[model samples]
Target: MTEIRWLEAFVAVAEELHFGRAALRLHTSQSPLSQTIRKLENDLGTRLFERNTRSVALTSAGHALLPRAYRVLQDMRLAREAALAEVEGVRGKILIGFSGAVNHLTLPPLTRAVRRRHPDIELDLTSRVRTRDGLASVANGTLDLAFVGVAESPDPSVVARLVAREEIGAVLPLDHPLAREKSIPLQSLAGDDFISPPTDGSSSMTEVLLASCMAAGFRPRIVQELSDPYMVLTFVAAGVGVTLMSSGISSIIPSGATYVPLDAPHHYMNHAIAWSADNDSAVLKAVLDVVEEVFPPVAS
Candidate 1:
């Protein structure tokens, strides 16, 4: 019978794609790791890896087994944690994925709450641009939760709970004429140079800004496109151009920039917390409860 030890060794080697590195991660020598992997392959009667002098890669069989093996390992880990929690009355880790913008507005408070409420629960946070990708990570058991924008409906496999909402606005140089207006009409800035966020099919802000401009009957003359909102605002403060932004971002506005709200009917953005529907960990549930208490959903 193939031992659990061999399965773990195979997984480590498959993930690292190198025997030496896999051995390092496993805290064992390369020779034993290699021997265990060979034994696993022999027991399974198939080659799991394609090895060469320069590189190592998973064979077709290995690729097919990877996801299943990962799930087994995850289940075992959860089981161990459950056993420990039963003995000590607390324990486990929750992985959180988020976007850059969400980090500024939501993550700090949520993390503080988690730390205060459940210090025994380890929290791991990662940043990513695409909310969909984050949701997928949760679905695949990679992430326990995610902080995402509520611009679109999420997948059925994931459950999203609204966290916060704020009005969208334009950021301009302090000296710009539009900065004088308390609320600027989107049409008023026609013909003005604009700096748009990059088109990565991830930033809902990009689509919202473009659509707002189109609704106002003008295609913005985009002079620059950037990935980071702070960078775009910096460019605006330098008089490079004007850019649309959310009120949550006002905290990061550069010294020379002023944020002005947009007029009625076109000025709001929603933020949400997402997690896998299948995940029912106490830590994730506790975090969700705190988020809901802090940022209740708004009716659209």
Candidate 2:
């Protein structure tokens, strides 16, 4: 019989796609981790991963098993949580995934509220660079919930609800020529190299900025892609490039960096809380309810 630990290791590796990272997540070394995978593959009679020197990828069988394995493990976890809840009312762990962009506005209040209201419930908060990865984590049961920037269109397996609409602006060096302006025209930035977030183009601020730039009559010349929103300002402050960010993200602007309002009045980004539609965890539902209560609904 395949044990829970094997599935747990498999899921971790599948989600991380790198043996080192997956081993770190599992609190083990690569040699035994590889052994665990090989053992599972032998028992199942199929390869789950295709790993070479520099890269690790999921095989087709691995892809097919990922969601199912995640679901089964999540069910087991929730079963444990449910048992605890019977005694403690609301006590268990919930893993929430979010991006660095949400630090200023969304995360602070949400985490504080959860702590105050449900102290017994444990939170394992993970911050990633892109909303796409966070949402995928939520969909695959790796994360109980995720906060992400989104468009109007929704994913079929994910239930995303708008919690806030944030005004977008440009991050510029204090001595930049445009920094003195009350509002800089997006077109004026046509020639500037942009420091953007690393995104897979599935509705990220990078893609949003690109689309906006194209509408403003130019394609932004991207010079750098930083994973941390806070660190993205480092290049900007050094006069290397400028990046567009939501107004609420001003909390992390470094000393030499300042936020300049973009000229687009109608431009805004939607901040949404997303979860897998099939998530039946009571702890997950409680967090969602808290979020909905703390924020207003999306405008029609």
TM-score of each: 0.76, 0.92
Q: Residues 212-269, candidate 1, lDDT per residue (tens digit)?
A: 7888889889989887667888899999989888888888788899889988767666
lDDT of each: 0.79, 0.83
Residue 278, candidate 2: C-alpha displacement in angstroms: 0.9
Model 2 TM-score, 2 decimals: 0.92
Per-prediction backbone clash count: 0, 0
RMSD per candidate (Å) reads 4.6, 2.1
After superposing candidate 1 on the true structure, give the runs of residues whose Cα lies further than 4 Å from its correct spot.
1-70, 151-154, 221-224
